[model samples]
Target chain A: MNHKEETIRVVNLETGYNSKKGATVITRGINASLYSGELTCLLGPNGAGKSTLLKTLTAFLSPIKGEIFIEQKPLREYSDAELSKVIGVVLTEKLSLNNMSVEELVGMGRSPYTGFWGRMNENDRMIVDESITLVGIENLKGRMIQTLSDGERQKVMIAKALAQETPIIFLDEPTAFLDYPSKVEIMQLLQRLAREKGKTVFLSTHDLELALQIADKVWLLDKPHGVTIGTPEDLALNDDMSRYFYREGVEFDRESGLFKISHKLDQAVRLIGEGARYNMVKKALARQGIDVVDADDCDVEIETTDNCYIMNGKEVPSIEMLLDMLNLYCK
Target chain B: MNRKTTMLLMLLLCLSIMAFLILNLLLGTVKIPVKDVIDILLGNDVDNRIWTNIVMKSRLPQSLTAAMAGAGLAVSGLLMQTVFRNPLAGPSVLGISSGASLGVACVVLLSGSIGGVALSKLGVIGEVTITLSAIIGSLIIMGLIAFVAQKVKGNVTLLIMGVMIGYIANAIIGVLKFFSAEEDIRAYVIWGLGSFSRVSGGQTTVFIVLMLILLPIAFFLIKTLNLLLLGDSYARNLGLSIKRARLLVIGCSGVLVAVVTAYCGPIVFLGLAVPHICRGLFHTSNHATILPASLLGGASLALLCNLIARLPGFEGALPVNSVTALVGAPVVMWVLFNKRKNEI
Candidate 1:
């Protein structure tokens, strides 16, 4: 797995839809390769064709131009049945399921391997149970799908994909409706699946920082710039993140490898701190248009301690008070 | 529920079907004793020749027709609900029943205009023609709807299309009725009222044979229906061809409804409600269980309704359509109320 195996290679792909009127291309001239044992993420602004790209790659939609290859074969060559044996997908569509247990829903993932009756054998049942365990949703096995929370449902769908035993998995906005913590959990789970299972996992998500932090490789699908593919650090170091998301008040913070809202702090203040709390105070001051500087002759000075902030000769217990004290003393 | 419990429920349903079939045979105008009815059914010659003729010709065929038609309608209903993914979908809801009525209406009017005689006078040949015409009529409508279904998405939209088409079919039927002679109109009205008693003698054999062939084929679709319950995209990703599955399910459901309507006159509510009742009873939507449950549950319920229709003191048997709606509506409402917008 560490030898860098390419599972999906797209050459000059153009993705969109066609109707009676004609074909409308969404994104074009995209060349990329997704590797096994790597969690690849596709990130873009809305309508940047992330879903379209996933659809085309998954063979749900025919590409307008260019070719996609799964392993060494062309995508068009694989029949729907063959593709099902190789790839599993979790879509963004809302499930309207009723009266089906979580275990049964996961069991349906073995459809490609089941006979006409779809009655699972012992091995299929074991695989289904293993998938539930793998997704860490053993507790939800007996629960009805209708009763599951959004996060639990998402996990069960992932378990279903796992039960399919496909090498490649594609998910569309898997973290879209989840809370912040659940979003992180789903992302980390996908990363772990890629690492431990050596499966090629590709997903499109709007969780930017989470993807930047956890993805093995990232595809930035900006509107003007086609697609920028690299590791997260490479994109941040090359200033691709900044250029792709070019806008006032938003700048990529290279030190954290995350984006931040940059403030043009014309006024400067001397700050004393050296750790986590210090950076928090610095970011807070920057948001208020005040810059932390090294100059000694400052109208106001805020120094961080274990439990208090010594700001403008007054002891403030919290950052909120420090802001208020600065308002009183400096403004 | 587990398999043993579901099997127990199925066994109970089968027992109920047998009990109701006996009840239907024993309780009638003649009021034959249970012993006598059993003796007659065991192929023994009874002392009362008149009793033998009545049981063999009337009650036996009616009971069998009621049970088979009920099973057919229920299976078709389950299929309609699955393919449309709506709680309210059925042959009746989807206008296929109206198409059957339209087919019969056209046949009745044509026979009336050409022969200058009522449809009742045409006898066995007439019944066969009506059955064939009704099947053709409903199947044609079902084919149209299936074609439209390919173009349309959304449950409510397809339902709305179904309801609209039903209204159009009813309108055409209304025009046909206007041209029909008085006796033809009366015969048409009686057929529309729906009856288990209408199918008797050799006509009963044809209806039963048709259902026997059609209903078993529906079981093969349990896998397809289960996959469809996951919705279109998920089912497709699992290697199902949605268009083919939809067409097959609708066609199967359509033929079942067509035959039942041709034989029983658009038996209402059994097709739509039996699946819901089965889902409620089994507490699962897996079609492997629900289809069989629907089959047996449908037979029991229809027999119960048939028994109720011909109960003591009434002048004649009640229209099965009226009894089915009366009994089925509440069962549906109760299930819906308990389940609260949950679908089959």
Candidate 2:
């Protein structure tokens, strides 16, 4: 899946904080390579050292052992100024600039390239305009950053990074506090950016299903596992995806390649239907801790059609009515 | 608006400075005519020696002192607020003024306790001692803050530390005052009251020249200040050296406050409120615009306050500190209310 050239490579890396006693290594011996023109998602549970890894990768924190190479140069070698031109970052902190216009905010990305006075030249202004247009925020160019919604602010940040024109972009939980559609939209935008712009887009996220759907490459990070890198389908096919995320009540459904909550099967119903309607009835029944099966031993039979569910020879207008009929008849 | 309009506004503000400066000279306790004031300024021999002496010796220098002190304090306040990212941050917020006062207290109270020589009687030597002591005190506090800023990560923490240091200095000043004579205490209290006409002749020249030099140097920080407004992480990511930048800004601001407080007796409000007024007027935090705008606005406001303080009815110029507070408090309140209304 990684057909493009590798932009960043991590080898035998150890990342964590340094205490007075000794090094507190969160995760060790991590080997990973991020290629250009790919969207990589670093998926992990809480306290899985995702942020530590991100911080280490961005050179914010020093790695205890091993080395990281950015564009074949040692990450430690590039000066902050040189590295900035190569790798842009978007952090999770809320920006406090209240009176700054979106255009000015994005124009700040030209800092490393601008002169001592930081006055933007024509080329810089054109790049800023292009980045804003790329993020589809041209209408918001004149608006203040404080007036924007969280989603729009995130987009503006992305535009800022885009204006930086770096080969790689690293974001720390960019979709964390956004609404559902906003999360999906941001993920999709990042995915498209990586694919179209040939950037090595790396982000750490808690959104499992969104990442699975959008990421070109997924890095499953766990404390014990260290790092597992591959495409989403490959990780799913090799059964590497299920081992780490496994919990008591959650099961990875291999058929659809998604995680589903494993419900109790104390109550049973034989679901008889096909297509979308049957799936809806099965899902509704599962919510009530009722199991759906094809066996005749079940007491209640739910036969679903295009818009209605028939249970026990009585036609129910909706899933709600079907649940009510099941409660009355099955008991 | 565009850069041209921004420049025009700055020019308009400069014009306001000139207008206020002239008004401050003309409208004082003696009520010198505009013609006499202009003639005196043009180096012409005025008919009345008393009017000439009053206009040249006192009014002109006092007006210049007030304008420079206001501009310096306001610029320093802008730097502190931007660096600390706290709206309420000012030169005094970091206790730099207390540092200066502490220095003055040490000299005044110690002299009174040891030799019975009042602060007003120390002559030229006493004035020089006060200036040197004030500079030393503020520099020591600023140096401590710069050292702590290196060790600490948060600006808020540094701010609190500065406040604590100020409290410590104030506590020492209180103890010194308790042991001193009544005349010494009265002198200290009057100094605390603040005045713009305190400096004249050689001292006034030194104060104005130092501020002129420092103000231009502060302009060199325009780029750094703009970067700083992006906050620490982003500023660092943009190749700014956060520790070094913080130290430079804090050092510049500390020196500005030190110089102004030494000359003007801890004048308030101009430093704390002028930046906010500029921000509200321009509706942008870009230091390129805000810096010059603050400088001009502060000068104009200070000149206006000086004029009001020296109105024909008031005896010995109604205390400047009270006038600044009475006038500046409303502007601050209005800006805060408008900012809240805009939800900025």
Candidate 3:
């Protein structure tokens, strides 16, 4: 394993857009360090400036205040050509391309390295093949980019970024349009690239559950709080994630590392048993305005065992019947 | 899609351009013998001096003008399509061709009505006035478009702006036609019909020289053009300065359209359809192949159109515009209809 190093260091960064009208700052006083050999995910509500920060760090939008350092040098000092060699990005902008083969599109990633005409030598070709192999989309090299599914397209874009051979990769919602399994696949692929290649991989995503599970570091951006950066485990344990999503009816469950809706316990009943069936039965009861309690109380105690529900010595064959009986008995 | 196949297709396109060029030079109203035409082209003695004169003075310049204008307009179309990332965008999509027509309308229509000058009286001098005015009009629009391209961040916004400008120019021309003398309106209408032979011998050399210089310059942009296929954000992250590339591409396309429309009188359908044809035949949108294919395909199609325009039945010569839309529109419609799912 390669040792982690701070490839990108930010101090008191204020990011936004500058129009002829005036400079409108989006986020203020954001101090963060993005390290190589780790996967960092930025989580925030919509319009919280996650994209603005990413754009500023990648030099798409100039920062309104503070400074950014790439490889211990000032960000402003690096030319656009120099910065392209250092960072690769997969953006959320929908590509409207047609009749272009996958390899040709991926070969375009070599622009920063190739000469003016962008003719790739053998070494560049080998790197492109390796990138496709890494992303496991070798089957798609000959197919047109427009024909590929959304997940396949996302993988192709990632492979394109990988082919650039940069030390840092920034993705804006890389998993936005992917299915659940594909989302997990993309997240794992990014994490593996960061760990194996020692590349600093950073991305902003709305997939909070997936990021909490797979990311090595998480940066939480919200309106009032500028940015809260820590490991996912540390953030969840320190109640940072919970505090970030603090609302009237939503509670961030530290145990599951997920946010759950806090339902009112209007009527409580004793429910017993554990395992998959028990959880399903509990869910069915909870949906019907009945709260499951650990302590024995009131009447109507239901026990689940051997894929069957028993209430007051009456064996219930199915959850539907159990719900029916509970409705009648509770009434 | 492979290199070998692309090379073979490119060679085929070049061969077609040659074959069509020869047919255009060989077949005409005069029906000069193929051997004699070849002899005359080779600078050998020919029995008939008139045949030699017709081939050298008329057909040669006309065919060369059509070929170069076709290639130039096709390349400019490819640039516009890539910059906007819109498949429907063509050389005149920026309203540059309309600007040229407006200039010709002002010079031709206004000349007879206001200055008491008829095209019959002015003759060749009137042609020069019209061409120069077309140049002035289109360059003014090109300059305006290039200026706006730098300030606007959105490609679609620039596209819409160009389209609105074109509409405004056409509206002005409509008003000019309403007030013009009948003879002046007829002259303006003839200019609007478009012809390859309108550019005289000296101007033919100039047009070819200009396109010969400008077309090769587009090759230097193949890399940037390819990156642009990935859309603006990806192109920018690839180290392509999007604004600069936009300005350069819009400038290249605008100048090419301006020159072609000024000389050729807004030749239509060749610029819009040739790139689409190349894409269909090559089955790839990579500019490295599509750009050259469009060039050669355009020249071949234009030569074919010229030959058909001057065929036996047509009196004098059919307008090159009608010939192009007649022969070229179906192939483009078929390519577009088949690829309706992915228009670009």
Candidate 4:
């Protein structure tokens, strides 16, 4: 009921499902806070209870421990309509709408604010149209939702959330089915929403790279039932990323800013190129047990004179010829 | 469609429905001129007593019954479709109609030996007994479907469960038929043919009153129904109690189906087909328009079928169910096929 500087505060939250056998605790003793004008990405592996936590926060499910407060008041204290006015959720499931224009579907976002008849007044229409333009789907406003592609559908879904005019929006895997480009676009849209609209945007994503690139703060769910919340760079610099994705062979390389797996290759190969093409060739060579070295390295040599070439006192013609020359010279 | 054009079309549809009702009153096995039919309806003393009896007793109730059954069935269908979130869902699909049929079969075919009086004795007591039994049967089946619908989240699974329930009701009806006497069986068979004329003047009042009570409840729940189309979780997020909304929808739909069946003997296809037509006409899923549109559409379609059922020069009136299937099946098929191609 109190709306003083609205924020989502979670204290010592423990969430998981239980059966007769025992409780399978996901995340325990978690304390987190999300405020306006920020985009928070909840990053974790599959089955790490990211969705469970999101659902609990949205009041879809109750947590086993601690309480969540929106605007310093307990979440349970707010009625469903009141909560809806504050929190708008975008789920990963497909909506069950057919033959409805983009405008009509987006208008449903204003349902909580509408009267019992669900009629859209002029203000409601303006909000819906503004949401469509916010998502940059104004041209497709008249198109049927069924005809839109997955990426477009996702944008429309977000637009629907925006139409709700809620201060806090929670999206579960907003880019789950989108390609790399679409993923970046969606994340950027969420970022813009947070920054420009002064709304709090919370999303769970498996796209770790995109999340790291765009999120203002990352809620990293790691093993041993712990979570670390900070800026993406802060989490990366603190080496928290390694703990979250702890597998046997894979390692997070801080220098390359990417994940790498240990390889058992004996030979290294030299290649000539620059930029993305060179990186692509290096990756291709790595898969074949041939690591790429810079062309300027002194230890590597290029035999140009195929019919009469010598390198390190060895003559080579073709690659086959080089093999023959190495065989003869070694003998 | 533009708003004005759509409103105009709807008005014209209403007019056509009214015209069909007038035609149904005038034409029968013994033909009467349009002028005399109008005069008789205005309470004029006519020379032909038989004509008056036929028009007032047989023709008038038949037409009104058809319209009511149509409206009731169509609204029932619309509610089922929206609640289940499946376009194919209807009273027949959920076995509610079959339950009503089973109740009728039992009372008319099997319960005659208990007393000298038949089930269709045409009194307050007989009518009340039949109506209550039908309602009880429909409620039982509706309750079962509602229970399963909650547990199983998928629309396909829910539809399959409804069909299975209908099959079970049919099996029970077959068993009851097997045990019934020849005369009682004949009577049940005639009822199974389905006619709107079975509803007398007394039954018409009961039918209208029940409809008035139930239809408004459906309209009042339109907001919840609209939220439901977004799915349960979304509805919950919108502050609707999902369980309560589902119960209300099922209860209202059950009452609609039960009353129509009790009086009209399972008028088929209207409930299954009319909502799709309404949706097609309106081109919107918002229940604010779709619900009332479906009610009026259903009433109109029923009146149309009633007029067709009593086409002049026929030896006897065609079964109302047969007429509805003839008309409704094609519309349903078109909706299904069109949706498949368009991926709606």
Candidate 5:
């Protein structure tokens, strides 16, 4: 792992919007320092001020009261053009551009570095190419933005931000609309970028499980607790995850580092077989309010092999027969 | 689009513009040959004095006005659409032109009550007053929109507010028409019909020169417009001052529409439709391509319409609005229809 360097430091920052009625502060008096070579996930439930914090950090919204330093320089002291070189941002809003190819869109990231006419030179083109390859989106470079799937479009946007050549990147819900595999891939890509390029990759997302899996550091935020920064394992072990995310029927599983629904199992079943089939049966029964217990004395016992399931001592050909026997006997 | 394809398309558009401009000069009510038109353009004395005077004084200025008005309106439309991120957005759609019309209606319809003199009786001075009032009315509305834009976050809300303002302006114009005398109403109606021929000689020179200065300035906004297409959040995060960019673009577009409407009386459809034609033709939304393409496309379309308006059968009496609307509407429809298959 590369040696870490502090990139962004926040001291007693209050973040939110100023409305017509009054100052509406979302998170207040927060202090945190984001480091290079770290993938920090800003995890929070909806309306937990994650976006507000991000907007404030990126200087889109003014900090209500406090100091934010980028590269140890006060953020407010840097002009917009200067700040743009220090921090790049990938917003959640869909680009309304049409007939523009991915390469053209990504090239727009060089706006701050370009001259008054905003023309791209050889070095800018090289940076754009490097960014496109960094995001592994070279194939989509020539494709129109409108033709891209949601996942592809998200990658293109990340490439655009990468092309900005900033040391720090802020993304708001980068995986919001992607499919399962795409979500995992995007999270992994961000983590890899942070580690390999020594970039501070800060992103806000609702994908708690994925973030826990890949995030080097997690910023747990909620309405009550402004923000708690730590490693995912540390937060889990310290019970801060449960404190912020736990509800009536939802429980945080420390073993798996995931949140699972905690519902009462009405009946217990014994599964005698092992491996994937047994686990599959156990999961299916668990969803139907049946618990798979290791106790050997249970009345209902399910044994699985390959594609076959046996109920008690009778062999059942498929999972349907096993489910039928359980429904008949468990009641 | 690649550089070659874009360059080729621009070349084609320029050729079309030249062809249409020459056609506009040659194919008017008076049957002037191509040879005479060229000679007059080259500053050589022509065989006939009437032909010389007609080509140099009247047709030349009228064609130049149409070209400038067309280019200015098209560029304004492109700016408005990009700023609002709406395909339907145009200079007229923002009520700026209706504001201009309302100003003219006030001067022409309520002349006797306001100044104790009819506008028709004032002659040359009355024309100047009418143009000034039109510019002032449109500027007031533009200022109001700019103020609202500073406070509002969403572009859609601003667009809807602009449409409502247009409706309110038209309603006031209707009320003014209801109370006006028949002759006054007729004069206002004629102005509302729109014309490129109204600007002639020295006035045409001033109009074209002003547009020449303004249109190139609009091109300087190409970078800003491209950034705007990324939408507000990205634009802001990319170091754009959203409010300042919005105000500058809106102010530029508003002034363009105001000046064009002041002179040509709210020549509709061309401003609303020419940008779409350029987009469809180039298949790209990059302002670098769209801006110049729209200028050439607008000028060509305007010249074509002007040619049809001055056909021998119409006796140079047809309103340019009728020609523009009749031609521009179908082109807009076709572009929209084609855009459904592709993306904007």
Candidate 6:
């Protein structure tokens, strides 16, 4: 642990939508400290106010009460240009850039730092190029943004944020529409960004498995109340997980550290082997529903068979043939 | 192009515009060479009084009107497109032009019927009625569109609503046309055909002043517009007052559209087509470049259309709108058909 103080602090924050009547409070009294160089996943079920909280935290919505601080300064105190230098954002909305090339789109990340006319100088170009290379989309630099795939577009967006060179990055459901592999890749990239580059990444996601596997800390947005923030193991051990996710006959298996249906019964499998092959054989035997027993106590003979099954010095290529041989011997 | 190159191109464009204006003044129904045109401009012309009157009064003001109208419509289109984040959005989409047309229709068709006794009693009131009605109609439609824009979240929906409003306004114009007399109908038809020659030297000053007021507002709102391109939430995240910014942009665009409508009688295509052409030419949507580029491009395109309209062989000048449509429609169509598949 770096033992550094928290970089993002939210104290008693209340947020919601506003209407003619008054404010509609979605959730209240959320308190959390997001630390430096940490990958924090905001986890919650659908309609649990995860997005609202993320929006509030990112200053997209004004909190009716309490305060948010970045680097010990009040979030609202910073000008847009000043704040953009400290925090970068990746929104969920899709952008349309018809004539703009990928590099130009990425270059827009430096907007906050650019002059009044928004001209890009040599240093700005270098940063854009480097960010493009960092996101591993250098090959698509010349291509139009509208030509990129969804996953590729997401990466380019991330590259754009990276080009901003902000210390903290906030993403709103970046993996929402990505396939499983792409989702995993994005999570891994985020982890690498936090660990290697010392950047703090805060993202909202419903992908609990990926969050549990990758995040340094998890903030679960429980319904009708505030959020719970801790390590993934801490939340799991405290049994706070069930409150966020509810499905009939489904439960978290503490021992295996995975989710399983409560109605499912375990079918035991036994195998005899010494090292690497032991687990492989166990898995193969588990698929067949046959138990592998110890050699001394087993009634069945064990041998390495090639091209045919040989038991007690008899060769039988087919199961029927082996059964007939056994009946003949018994008679 | 590089910054220097773009700057140089803009300069060349300005120079060419000046040259075209001079040429338009010199060569018209009666042939006056370039030297006589320059000499007339300098107040030292040894020419026929009729020729001087034509050069000084009609041709000069007409050319200036064409340039100003072109620039105004183009800037309005550019601003509308940026604010709405739609390539297809224009001043016409919001029925501002139709509003002007409706005003003209009422003047030509309903004036005699609505205020026959008043017209006979007060002739000045009749002329004032027409201009005021047109200005009021444009303002009313602008107000409606601005209200709708505040309510609507999606750009595409706003665009569709604008088109519907235009259709409804045109329907009202259709009804007015049914009651109009042939002479009145001819006057309205000629206005509908569009003309820069209608603006006198005095009106040109008003046009320039209105543009001067509106262009700065557009420039001042550039930062907010850039934030807006990222969408509302993102803009809010950046601490931009989105509602305020939207109002400012809408107000600016309304003024631009209204001024052009008041003067040029809803000249077509410049507002709808020039912005896209400028965007394509500049290869960037950043308003810093696009705004000025659209202005120059609009000026050039308008001058070209005006020149084509006044080509010597034609018995009378072709409709300015017809010339612009012939040039502009193809370019806009190409943009629509060949647009990249992944654009929103």
What level of docking quality does candidate 6 show? acceptable
Give lDDT tens digits, candidate 4, residues B1-344: 45786687678768877888888887777888887788789999888988888888888877877777788888889999988888878877888888887787777766776565676665667667776777778778888888986787566787788889899989988887787777777767776777777767777777777777777778988888888888877777767877778878977898799888877778778998998988888787778778878888888899888888878755577888889999989998998788743353
Q: Residue A144, candidate 6: how far off, in angstroms?
A: 3.7
Model 2 regions lying over 4 Å from their true place? A1-3, B335-344
Question: Would you list the C-alpha lDDT of every candidate in the order shown?
Answer: 0.89, 0.89, 0.89, 0.80, 0.89, 0.76
Please, what are the lDDT tens digits per residue for candidate 5 over residues B102-182? 889888989965666778777778888888889998998899899989988899999998989989999999999888888
Worst 10 residues of 2 chain B by lDDT: B335-344
Candidate 1 residue-wise lDDT, A141-222, digit = tens: 9888888888999999999999999999999999989999999999999998999998999999988899999999999997
Tell me how far candidate 1 lies from the true structure as C-alpha RMSD in angstroms: 1.8
For model 1, the DockQ equals 0.59
**lDDT string, candidate 3, A1-331, tens digits:** 5799999999899998998899998899988899999999999999999999999999988999999999898888988788888999999977888888889888988899999888999999999999999999999999998899889999999999999999999999999988999999999999999999999999999999999999999999998988999999999999999999888878898888888777666887888899998898878877777888988666988899986889888999999999899889877
TM-score per candidate: 0.96, 0.97, 0.95, 0.88, 0.95, 0.82
Better of 3 and 6 by lDDT: 3
Clashing residue pairs found in predicted model 4: B73-B271
lDDT of 3 by residue, B171-234 (tens): 9999999998988888888888989998886778888898899889889899989988888888
Query: Which segments of model 1 are wrong by more than 4 Å?
Result: A264-267, B150-158, B339-344
Q: For each candidate, what's the DockQ?
A: 0.59, 0.59, 0.71, 0.47, 0.60, 0.31
Best by DockQ: 3
After TM-score superposition, what is the CA distance of residue A112 in candidate 1 from its true location, in Å? Answer: 0.5
TM-score of chain B of 2: 0.96
Candidate 4 chain B — worst ten consecutive residues by lDDT sum?
B335-344
